[model samples]
Target chain A: MNIKNSNIIVLVSSILLVVGFIISIVNTMVLVSPTEHIEGSWKEISWEYEKTESGNTNKKISDAIKTEICKELIIHEAEVWNFLAGGNLELTSNTNNETLSWTMKGRGNILELSHKTNKIEHYNIQILNNDKMVLYFSTDIQAKGIVKMTFEKIKEDSYAQKI
Target chain B: MLRKFSNSRTLKDNIQLGALSAFSAGMVNVTSLIIFFAFTSNVTGHYAILAEEISKGNWYQASVVFAWIFMFFIGNFISNIIIINFNHKNAYAAHSAPLIIEIICLLAVGYYGHFYYRETLSETEIMVGTMLFAMGIQNGLTASISNFSVKTTHLTGLTTDVGILTAMFTKKKYRQNKQLRSKFNVLLAIAAAYLAGGIVAGVIYYEAKFLVFFAVSAVIGFIILYEYYKLKVTKYIRIKRTIKLRKGILETT
Candidate 1:
């Protein structure tokens, strides 16, 4: 390896690194806009809470408690959230429906859902794509930890049929 | 240690490089696991996940895993490319360049995690990928410069080597082999250091959080600076010896 070759290699590595950094930033900007991808109806696919116990151990909550929590959150089986264009979010399940206002902040990563009583809930958007959205939030209630909720976009035809 | 290739590296050099890099690798691996729910140092589990995701037809997850693997691969590739191209002109510089990059990556992760990280999946994924690349660079440089004798990121191979050597030691002839003993020592040092690093990081993470990365970077920086200091000392001694010899000749003449 000569000096010239070494210089070239260093230059190339630096360029590649800069390019990679740029691409990563650009990809985040272009591929992850919550407002655009988050609109429309979404069905809850799964929800999980990871609790940190002693020794930094992580344990998932029991099924019964998980079910209760899900029920409390109005996210029972086949629960859906219809995110309308004008900041309206409609949460519906088999037996219940509720409407909430939603706004995104922090580069479309922080989702703030507001109720009529002026209560606001914030969820960090883990992932938001055309077909799926994963949101995460922390809770200090029973089995305190972070909760991750995954949702799949409900296709227009299926949503129409359900309506 | 800085300029010597693997065939020429002493047992001391091998142990020093292996242990320090392994320690940092362990810290990065454990810290990323604790914070991001991902492992950044090694790709074996990621490969398995990739396979599983592919089998399950989860393209998104499979692709993410694939990208992680690729980032690790590129880290190795870039490090080796730097080394092979520049080992002749300035072996130390060639070797240190990758560590510099690794340090930068770890620092970025640490700073962002401490101040700006929102604990989002995107943030986690990007940070993990950055760490994987950093680890790859480290693994590549150590292995390449040491003539493939040192791999600090993962212990599966080292553990296997140790197992084989231990089994061989059951024979008297193998016990008499100095090379085998040296290899065993290097492996043991790396394994112990890796475990120690992980334990330290785990304990410190409770208090320092992402600032643990700064500690890891300092460890790596010590490795590079120590070598540079050694190089300078060696050069200074050589200059002093040459001057003494010249003075002696002048007096005699």
Candidate 2:
């Protein structure tokens, strides 16, 4: 290539580099928000009720059932929270096999949860209420898909009821 | 136009240069998907999205992303064919043709991806893929032309070289000239452009979909054509210089 073409090559290459550079910056800043942090084990529960054509359950019934379910789940929230937050605690009743077993690090209201066994991602913990805490997974996929179960703190000595 | 300067190199050398950018493109493309459900030049991001959708029970969305990923691979394959088949027999022509194609493809993809096919591909995916492919093709073209003397597409490797060069410069042992200057400029440009591309994509992805890729395509097109135009100007200058030299010699005789 001549000096002219060489310069052209340089120019073209520079443009590509610049374009890539801009994209890298954009991905970091715009698309991804920094993961949130929290402390302790929290209770998280998600439920989806599809409107089935054959089912007679209407919106009002579903809403009332959901409310009652939340109310009933309130009692076990603290114990669930303790089990989740407490180190080295094993659950014989967690039959779902979805419980992520990972060594968690970080402190109150800002927990950084990670599991070496699961190569997926880290979890951000949040305390939603006195008896419920929330674990925010890396992507929104976790939020939209699965029903998360977590617990919130209630009192010191006496533990809340178990689910 | 042909006799201005002669630097002959083989196809293998060019492939090696293109490989640097292509590999980097793969990494960035995959990472972009990990961070955003987008495909960078690599199809892995789309795969991840497909997996995520399966997990989320969104079969429809998953299928769509899968189709988009398929298109990306098709685009890459087509580009490779064009580069191989339609390229120039001459060294310069061969190199220039690929770059031109890359430039054109990026522009088309950007426009189609942004405006016409807005709903088909997400904002982040287009940005990632376009940038990755553009870099890949740019590296391929430059490498072919310069015989692997230059690489501006990927900076991870270039940055390492720059570090070594900086050390060499600091040692004050080797003299630096236009060649070194060009290398330095390329290094800086790559770094700056990558940074800029990220920032631009981020902003556009927020404001609207497809706009980011559209903008990126325009930039790539301009750069490719600009280089060719610059080459023509250089040819003109060289011819003018030769004429002047001939006149001087004749007058003296």
Candidate 3:
């Protein structure tokens, strides 16, 4: 109602606005949608048995079994998974390159990958963020347990871009 | 189906409403699953996702899921409010309003996805949100009208009920109970219809894509129109009987 009161109100409101904007930016830096978090070149770090039923402590899975596990899977041991915009996924390894499509289901909890041949594979997204994405998939391989796949986000797509 | 109130609804009415609505729900769920990669008819998984997002500190996604959940809640609230407030005035109007809104929502999603869809995050989010709202309206209306006997949105409780009914039928007394048998028949019809709808939609989605929503809308439209036709026929029969009785009284006088 008074001039001084109005001026003080404006000053406080402007300060609040600035503070809110700063917090939003900071939060955005830390937060990302599943799509945004997944849209990059991710190199496969390791493949390990998530759990064993026979109490076998051999959690370490060799890369050889990867082919058997991925037998029905079109992504067979693809070392690098590059998720691009518009549902395009470029999978590559040391030997050859493959292309597929990807979509996130159930609030980004499920990563569904579809090959051009109409073969579909779903991977449960255990933990996904800026730097790391952990995935789990059921395997009927020799060790009948969940297979945990860990992947690290490639900051630069230079290596992936080559293929 | 739309004309009857809760206690007055017969077993036939309940089964008809349950089967058809469940079929449409299944179709919508599968279609949304294929297109948006989200389940629209069911909110249970969405609840889990909301919790996960909140726990993970992804405030944006948490808020998105929160909004989606809220849309569903608000849809149910609005459907129930319409029914409770207007049923005393006009049961048919009260029941039909939510379904009309549902049809509009589905059509909007279909139109947008068919024509203007860019498949962006925001677009997918909004489409899925609208679908969830549509499903909520449908679930609310069926449940409200049927006195909560015919909930067709999700199969979790329905499956549990079917399981319980099957277990009960193992006993001779429960097996002979007419009400239990009719309820079992209704539940089984709904489950079968839902699965059939899902399989049909899944089979057709690859070909029809967004156009399948038009088929869903048609199914809901058929329910509304069929009820209207039945209401008209019943009204006509009652009017004819009343006129004949008046004529007989006049002749006697």
Question: Which pairs, if any, clash in model 1?
Answer: B6-B146
Among all windows of 10 consecutive residues in model 2 chain A, the one with the lowest summed lDDT is A138-147
Candidate 1 or 2, higher DockQ? 1
DockQ of each: 0.08, 0.03, 0.18
Model 3, span B120-177: residue lDDT tens: 6667777888999999999999998998889998689999999999999999999999
Per-prediction tally of clashes: 1, 39, 0
Which tens-of-lDDT digit does each residue in B1-253 have in candidate 1? Answer: 5668879999999999999999999999999876766788888888787777568654545555666777898899999999989989999999999999999999999999999976455566678889999999999999998888999987889889999999999999999999999999999999999999999999999899999999999999999999999999999999999999999999999
The TM-score measured for candidate 2 stands at 0.42
lDDT score, residue B66, model 2?
A: 47
- On the 0 to 100 scale, the lDDT of residue A58 in model 1 is 44
Of the candidates numbered 2 and 3, which has the greater TM-score value?
A: 3
TM-score of chain B of each: 0.98, 0.54, 0.97
Give the number of the best model, judged by TM-score.
3
Interface RMSD of 2: 14.9
